[model samples]
Target chain A: MLKHTPFHDFHVQQGAKLVDFAGWEMPLLYRSILDEHEQTRKSGSIFDVSHMGRLHFSGKDAVTFLNKVLTRNISEQKAGQSRYSLVCNESGGVMDDVIISRDVKNWILVCNASNREKLVKHFTKVRHDLDLDFDMSDQTEGTAMVALQGPKVIERVAGVLPVDIKALKRYQFESGSYMGMLKFTIFRSGYTGEDGVEVIIPAKIAGMAIKLIAGKTDKPDATIKPAGLGARDTLRLEAGMPLYGHELTQTIDPLSAGLGWAVDLNKDFIGVEPLRKIQADGPKRRLVGLELEGQRIARQGTPVLLNGQPIGEVTSGTMSPTLQKSIAMAYVDAAHATEGTTLAADLKGTQVPAKVVKLPFYKRAQ
Target chain B: MLRKKAMPDAPKDYRYLESHEWHKREADGTITLGITQIAADELTDITYVALPKVGDTVTANQRWGDIESVKATSDLYTGVSGTIAAVNNELTKNPGLVNSDPYNAGWMIKIKPSNAGEFDKLLSMDDYRKKTGH
Candidate 1:
């Protein structure tokens, strides 16, 4: 059985087509993927990301435990600030990508839904070594996460929550109350390449809050439509972001996936040795963005060919809503991975011509 | 290519199938083919269409083409055994025509039937409705 979110019925009421994705029964789209995608790019859209995992760490040695567990340095982060981080195995391969936030008394780590149980087990085993009094809890079941994205999301969300959100910089969050009834944390961060906020609230009041936000008619320009995982995939692809299972996995290192900037060599952390070796010897294969010449969108695991020989495989592909052209990301042999180089992606029996472009196929207007 | 208006009824001119495909017997021996409204509604907005070669022989109850949407992909089955005569090339540019007008301009393929007698094996309007659960 697939897990259902608190807003499952609300999605069905709004004409969403539901499908199972990574064990969660979520909406694929309400009406049309293109319409929802365009709406998010032009104005705003709301997504029910409640299925994502949230874990809280509270202990006297919280900072010490985090420094040992996370690849990025978490000891220096000021309270109320968040940063992207990674969990890796001893071999220097990525285990999971996470966002680390420092609260006053505890540290909050948000992880991907599919990796929740596995990550909990990994952290449990390493907890005893840090010499800290810490309690780890998976708060995903009781939390409701909603993302309001696009340029006007701040103004629309600020009308309801009691906080001066204007002062919140990117990746910064603060705890605030909504309608004097619910306490939650609002983060100025989102997966989509847009200005947005992700609100984590109590699961009980989730449906009511969504209803209230969707019912707002005074903000005409801020139209809130329910988006599903389908649009979410396409949106993130256009932004040149990597999916955990697709572009990122335990077998691949961050350097090969164009994420070298996230690693800090000064910190002694797990997976540092292999990462350093990969940086020195260069990765066998590198990830690249493909701008397809035809309309047939490449799919994951599709073979990439150069000079009629298989060179790599596509990790993610879709018809980009922002660019209107077919776009894809794939890992190919480093010898053939260069911007402006021509490649072919085998789709079924046909080979579609593609050009190796820079990372992002679509960029938000400056 | 001209767009077809949604008729009040499935244009009485075309033959219907239980699997929600439409066949239009032309003045010539050839026939034009497309998916019906029921099938289009089920498939939603068509993203890509893959049709067989023009001269390939298509057997009844066999796969001739395929259509894909964001969520699902379904094979286009042959209702009558025939030789591929022509295909709607416009669909390459605008596949949404399959969703907007499935009977006329959205016609997928044209066929020169080898066994015209087999046409009787397909469903009528009443039988098609029952088979589609609509």
Candidate 2:
């Protein structure tokens, strides 16, 4: 049986097409993928991200333990700051990409749902092996998360939320209590390439919190509409974000996934040595963005060819609703990973023309 | 039990395959084929329809072309074996017609069926509705 998030009933009432994602029965789309995608790009969309794993860390040893495990150096991260980082095995291959936040009293790590169990086991094993003393709790089941993303999101939420969301810079977070009862954390970060905030609330009060923030679902002119995993996937793909199972896996290292900025090579961590070696020798393959000539999508495992010879494979792809172009992210050999390089995606038996471009296919106006 | 969502009815004269392809027998004895509304709804935001050219041979229950959406790809099939007499060229430019008008302007192909008896072998409107849980 698949697990259900706190907003499951809300999704049903909205006529969502529910599907199993990472063992959680989640909404894939409420109305149509295109409509939701457009809504997110134009206004704002509330995404039920409660299925993601939310792990809390406390105790004096928490900082030391996280610095040793995470690729990003978090010792200098001040309270109310969040950083996107990756957890890697000893060999520097990514186990999962996560967003680690430094709260006033504790630290929060939001990880991929598919890797939640595996990461819990990995972190536990590491802590036991090292004999470190820290309080780690899986708050995923007790808490719910939602991301309200778009250009208009901050303004729409300004009146409902207590904190000065406009003052919270990107990657900053603040904890607040609503109605003198409901405690929550709002982080100005999101997966979509838009300005927005991700809020975490108590699981039992999620339905009420969403209604308060998003306004009535029946409102025809509501600022934020409910989007599902379908639009989320497409929106992230257009933004050139690397998904865990698609772009980052146990065998794919951070250097090759174009996540070098997130890794602190100078600091001590579980995967630092191998990452330093990879940096010194240079990565064999690098992730690059591809814009295809036609609307045909280059799905995962599609062969990326350079003059009829396979050089790499597509990891994630979609017909970008915003751009109206077929775009994909692929891992190509370092030699052919230039921005203007031309490649072909072998879709079944046909070769479709593709061109390597910059990482993000779309960027919002500043 | 969860409430079953209502689905649009398949045309009374049409026959359907379990995969959701609908077939209509035209006055010329040729069979016109397209995906049912359920299939179109399932594969939302149809981006491209890879249609076979005229004169192409399509075997019953075999994959002829591919229908791609923003999220997934599905193989288009027919219940009747036939030679492709006409193809929906308009879909090449606007594949979303499949979702907007699955029964009318979105008709995929017109085929000269090698065996007209195959159409009668497909599921009727009521059976198709039952099979789809509508």
Candidate 3:
């Protein structure tokens, strides 16, 4: 049986096309993928991100335990600030990419929905092996998450939220209670390359919270319409963000995936040694962006060819709604991973000409 | 319990395959072929349509072409064996027409069917709706 999020019924009411995502029955699209994508780019859209794992940590050893496992130095993180980080195995391969936030009293970690259970087990084992004394609890089922993302999101959301979310810089967060009843945390962060806030509220008050935040207008042309996982994937791909299962797998290292900035080589983490070696020797293959000639999408595992020989494989591809072109991310031989280099994607037997481009296919204007 | 989805209107005079292709027999004895609205909705945001060349032979229940969306790809099949009379070139540049207007402007091909009796073998509007659980 598939698990349903707190907003499952809300999705159904909005005429969402529901699909199984990471063992959860989630909305693929509320109206249509293209419509929602355009809506997010142009105005604002609300995304149900409740399926993602939310773990809280407390106790004296919390910072120490996090510093031992996470790629980033968690001890340096300030209260109400979030930092993007990665969890790597002993071999320096990425386990999951996550966001670690230092709240006022406790620490919060948001990870991919698919990696939640595995991560909980891994954290537990690590704590036991290290004989640490932190209280780690998975708060996913007890809370709900919603991301209101787009250029217009901040202004409108600021009117309803208790705190002045517009004043919060990127990666900053604030906690407050609505109507002195519904307690929530608003994080000025999102997966989509847009200015927005992700709000977490108690699971029981999800329906009431959405109503309060989005307002009473539920028309199709409402400023904040409900988008789904489909638009979220496309938006992130356009933003050049690497997804856990697609780009950062168990065998793929963060350095090779062009995420070295998130890894701290100076810190003593679980995978720091191998990562240091990888940084010294350089990555064998580097992740690069590709713009195909036409609308033919180079799907995952499609071979990227140079001079008719396979050089790499595509990780993710989409006919970008924002760019109106076929864009993909692939790991190519480091020698050929330069902007404007010509390559081809072997779709079945046909070769579609591709050109290496910059990582992000779309960027919002400041 | 999931709510029953209302079936998109399938023309009474047209015949449909379980795979979602619809065939309409024209007055000129040619059959116009296109995917049903259900197929278009399922394959959201179609990005490309690869149709067989004009005058190419298409076999019954065989793959004639391919249609691509942002997230998935599906092979196009025909219910009637025929010579490709004409293919819609507009779909190459604007495949979204398939989703917006699947019946008329989105018609993929017009085939000069070899066996006219094949149309009768296809499912009627009522049967197709029942089979698809509308």
**lDDT tens string, model 3, A196-312?**
999999999999899888764358678888888889999999999999888999899999999999999998998899999999999999999999997789999999999999999
Deviating ranges (above 4 Å) for candidate 2: B1-5, B130-134
- Which CAPRI quality tier does the interface of model 1 achieve? incorrect
C-alpha DockQ for predicted model 2: 0.49
The regions of model 1 sitting more than 4 angstroms off are A129-132, A216-222, B1-31, B36-45, B52-56, B71-75, B103-105, B123-134
lDDT of 1 at A322: 78
Worst 10 residues of 1 chain B by lDDT: B1-10
TM-score of 1: 0.89
DockQ of each: 0.21, 0.49, 0.47
How big is the positional error of residue A195 in model 3, measured in Å on the Cα after superposition?
0.6
True contacts kept of each: 0.07, 0.54, 0.46
Q: Which candidate is the best by lDDT?
A: 2
Candidate 1 vs candidate 2: which has greater DockQ? Answer: 2
- Assess the local accuracy of residue A266 in candidate 1 as a C-alpha lDDT between 0 and 100: 73
